[model samples]
Target: MKAATATILVLATFTLLSSGKKFRWCTLSDLEQRKCAELSKALLAVLPLATINSFARVSCIRAQNTHDCIDKIRVNKADAVSLDAGDVYSAVKLYGLTVVAKEIYEEGNCVFAVAIARRGTLDIQRLRGVRSCHNGARWTSGWNIPLGFLLARNELLWDEDQPLSQVISQYFNASCIPGVGITSPQLCALCQGPKSYVRNKNHFCETSSSEPFYDSEGAFRCLKNGVADVAFLDHLTIMNGTDSDQEEYELLCPDGSTAKLSAYGTCNLGRGPGRAIISRHNFQKITKKFLTLIQHLFGQNGKERAKFELFTSVPFRGKNLLFRDATQHLQLLKDKAEISHILGLDYVALLKGLGHEGSSLDNSVVRWCCISNAELRKCEEWALNIKSDPLVCVQAASMTNCIELIKSNEADAATLDATHAYIAGICGLVSVAAECYGEGCAPAAGRTKKLTHLADKALPPVYAVALAKKNARHVNIHNLRGRRSCHSHLYSPGGWLLLSRYTVGALENNTVNCDIGSAYQSYFWKGCMPGADKNLCKVCIGGGEMEGAKVSSRCAANHNERYYGNMGALRCLVGSPSGRSFGDVAFLEHHNLLKNIESLQSSGWAMGYTLNDFELLCLDGRRVAVTDWADCNLGPVPPNIVMTRPVTTTKIYGFLMKSQETLETNLDSKFHLFHSQKYGESDLLFKDATQYLVHTSHLDYQSILGDPFFQLAESVFNCTHADILEFCKQDICTS
Candidate 1:
């Protein structure tokens, strides 16, 4: 494993660093490429605002992977190479290199190297004794080894220290010169498309190695024509297709959202040693220059990337899952010429069998569909009736057109299924209807007449309210008076109203919290989108299906920074990352008691306080809920955020502590969907699950369980110890 013979002369060809030009990192796709474009926008903005031309140029560079990028970098081409996180370490190791700048683009090593070949050689599976082409011997030291990989895959490895054409002759296998590179051909392949690869390469083959394919264009062409079933490519490469060429991609960069590639990082760096960089000086300069564009990283400039983070994380870690606010930090990196996040997403996915796709986050690329069958049927049916000569053109699969239909009042709403409802609802659309199972609504009941586009609707047990910030006003938040308030139901009507003032104020002050400034969910759940409306909802959760959970609507704008999804975010604020560890006094205060109730009662609302200080409220002829719980402090090392709430007490009862770990365990699939989570239960939700917790001390749920949802909880409540056995009666009932 030898390196370059001499210390490489460091020269930056990018005008951003030398020609006094800008730095650009381009890509294609809605997530990665969009993120790069967004970040680039911010860097561009930073120069004029800060009055600094530190970066001669700032732009996105589009390449296949790290190797190609490093090669380009070696030629003093691109200032910095943007690769995924996990592979960065590996590529550095493989290429035996170091880092200049880093940013956590994606969270994991999802990228895999695939061997590709002409259709005749499609069986190029485990290239054992068969001819194989790869970057040469010297490069394979820390990277890919054709022979070894073949052995593992149960194939033949016919590796030889030679160029690709020669290896093809001797061993019917060949290797690209180690570090000699494949980029040139990759580009050519893209232009010719896949058709040419088959006719040209004759018997082409590739080794699953790393990224920045010198010949990505070539490989793309090979795969396109079916010449190659698969290719040694990065995850992003497969996702974005290709820019067609350089200048064309640059045009798309400024166009928005279309420029992203893969979401997570890839791992195929040809199994390199370690990566090296030009020198620390260049690294420092790049870092310092990028740090100034606080807005790009944290602001609207990088929205596409933020959208990816939001979408991927929701399924990865359920809705109530917690994570530290990365907004501010990301915003800080905007201005510089080139910035990257080396460390990646540390959180792992809690995969749920989520969609039409299986519970395979790895094999699947989640796409939130904006239209559903029922809705599409309705649109077509109505299209027949309209008879107007307006352009009825649809981008076909365009979410933009779908969103515009609702926003511009051209259409009443957009519709989709439950699993996909999240996509429409997340950024900014209402899920007026609930998430429902797929119902083949192919043939409409009223074929001749236009009908409301509603599918197999989940019984509307719970509903969401969505609104755009620019449209609505009257947002508010309680003074809180330094009191820690655990405000759950972030987008709930009551929750939104309560937090409005604070959210609006935050936006006024330039904080990202209210970036959208007091928007509503309008039957939408999971999360919110940027420019959505209520009319977009077409999810039809028709009446009773699976039992909905027993939840209470409580309000107060509290604990924004404290909890995520429902988990703790930071250990503490105003200190080192770990400085604000839980203090010992949180329990003794029992802040959950009458403290807030007393304050509320003092203000006028009357309620009967009960054991554990539970309080029930009577507003207008119906009973409302109000309960108190202790706020967290540092005492006892491990602190339990005392539980007390009016709505559903069973879930949060019994020692649910004030730590992120506890939240994860409780909200886990087994314990959630509104089931009891026990005190001191370990990570697993199965063993020692808590049963029968107090819903509310003051109001016996059985008294007036008027709501159908309450009726179900009541039904379960009526069940006795005998009933429990009967319900679970695994006994063979042979009658």
Candidate 2:
């Protein structure tokens, strides 16, 4: 009767405590319920004794496990709870909870996670059909560390559409995973129902201590008793559990190194940062004050340490409550950002690995990125020749989109024009290979000996040229103002840079408009500059967009544009009827016009256009014949460079180097590997006039293009407010 009265009195006291005024501390449910009660009792005795400026009364709340406690904190049902490193990641990402305090242990503030097996019984790669034991799903020492590495190597299959827990169950023959949901029977197949709930069979695999193999010690015992062939647990648990018989177990490192359990710190997969006390981001100050007060009274040198051994001993009969066994005290963390830095990037990778399963990008394939349907067709042929073992083409909407794909680990490499290369370099991509152009009408056979690696040779500059009809109304370069013009794309060196330079130089003395993008929009009467802003695209005939694509002229950026690439720009110069058909002048590379003009001028050609009618726009403002291009063309432009992210550069270099060897050796084939013929276009991946691919290592934007040219490109593009210049507001390469 006296015990019942005391319990009633405590219940009434808790009922009077408002959530806003008191800290609701959460602990693991059931057996840990008494531990929660004990922590509350310690806080009651310690709050008055500590010298903290702000006093916070702490109350205890029981939750199913660490995740449940996190959910409680997220919903304001509880204020804080100490959790494992893996659980802290979930709480931070899923609920935006912040780490207020970290638990300090005697052995170390951190512990390594390892895979253990009976000596000579298992290896990391040969565990396909073996029974497994885990401390729990998403645990740092058990699941995330070891499993994250396996998933990265594709040793285990992964399917993101299905439950990650279900995928794990399918990988192992049978497994005991405590705290995993019972929605999938495969997860619960090997579980022996806990003794506490014999009638509820499904509750056997729960995270509570009632389950046979639920925690670090439980998982080790499961392996010891022959319930599982391999067990995932912490180094501390393995060292303590196997101390009685050293020869009974050995640690399995992914590198195939095996050693006694004591060497686990060195032989383990990875070390997880120690458990942390987390709270809602807003309640950090109050949470820190309450924990500091409790740590002072129950810490190693506390005066009232006898009331509750908060750090020295496990609270009550449970192994952990607000603090773990052998913990010295709690250390306050500044903020969530500091907590992320303490956890480190590799530990964050392990948490991310939990969500990824057998993704195709986790392979050795050199994913060649394409930005258009036309380029994709050519990429498909390249994929077929390589047979897709180590090389495959992945497509995105634009070059900028392709760079983003590399950042996200989706695509690997792409052949980018110099303009795109500058943008890619700003995004931290490295130049792995460059298209080497020499004096050749086509790639010469038996010239494989001259093909040097990217490091040995530099790409020859290609000249930019402006073309116009010999008998056009606007006769020369000086007459470009108020006349119709055409361009490949806004960023193309030939189409935009050369023309932009002339426009700015011609009107430099005028102060009406300093903005180049706006100036070009108003300068040209009506033009088909494929990728320009809406005003520049008003005269575009709308054939550039993909079928079923949105009805917007700005979408005419890639091959879909009537005047897109060098070839597309040349085709635009070959006029059509209906008045809006063609521009009076076209800007493109010198070689692109040479390859297509002879054919377009032939009566046999479908367009009925003649090269005889076109003339070159010279620097002296005079029109010249096609044969006099060497004397009339604009500045020499930088060549295309094969680029990939720095992380994947080496792997892609090896793959591309070998593919280039095969293509050069078989250069005389009816279907040329270096050139594309699908849409009567010769160059898609490499220039049709490209003699070979030059191997380059450790080459950057400023190095390959030269500092002066890079600055010139930067300045020229800056005139029109290029995205690359904006992205390079600071030196992203050095940063």
- Which numbered prediction scores highest in TM-score against the true structure? 2
Tens-digit lDDT track of model 2 for 1-735: 955754454343343343337668886656566766666665565543431222235567776556677888999999988877877877787678888877776555676788889999988778877898888777878788777556544565554446667777778888887877767566556667554444333347776566768778778888888999998988766555546546888988766768888887678876677677889988887677666555555678765788877663343555544566656667777764554355654355345435522334455466778877777888776766653245677877666677666654578788787778888777656777777776742345644533355453456788888988777846688878887778877777777765666765423525544566677778888777877775566556554323333455343767655456776667666654333457778888876566677656442223555667778999898888887878888777788888865444555666776676665566564445566655455467677767666666445666787665587666655445666444434321110
lDDT of 1 by residue, 1-735 (tens): 112211111112122354455554423222344455544454445334433354435665554334455555544455554333333443343343345432221322222333434333334333334322332222222123322333222222222222332332343232332232344343122222122244222212221122222233334444445433333433333344354422222111111112223321222322211112221234435533443233233433433344333212233322101111121122112222221222211100100110111223321211111222222333333333322221122222223344333322233233222211222322123322111111232235534211122333222211211111111122112222222222222221222222333333322334433332222232222221111223211111111012231111011111111211121111110111223222110111121222332333332222332233322211122212222111211111111111111111211221221111233344333323112122211111111112111112222222211243233222322331222223222211110
Error of 2 at 105 (Å): 26
Off by over 4 Å in 1: 1-78, 83-97, 101-107, 115-148, 151-220, 236-282, 288-295, 298-735
lDDT of each: 0.26, 0.67
Candidate 1: C-alpha lDDT: 0.26
Q: Which segments of candidate 2 are over 4 A away from where they belong? A: 1-361, 387-390, 440-451, 454-457, 505-513, 544-555, 577-580, 601-610, 666-670, 717-735
What is the TM-score of each predicted model, taking all chains together? 0.26, 0.56
- Candidate 1 TM-score, C-alpha based: 0.26
Clashing pairs for predicted structure model 2, backbone only: 158-357, 453-695, 454-694, 454-695, 454-696, 455-695, 544-560, 544-561
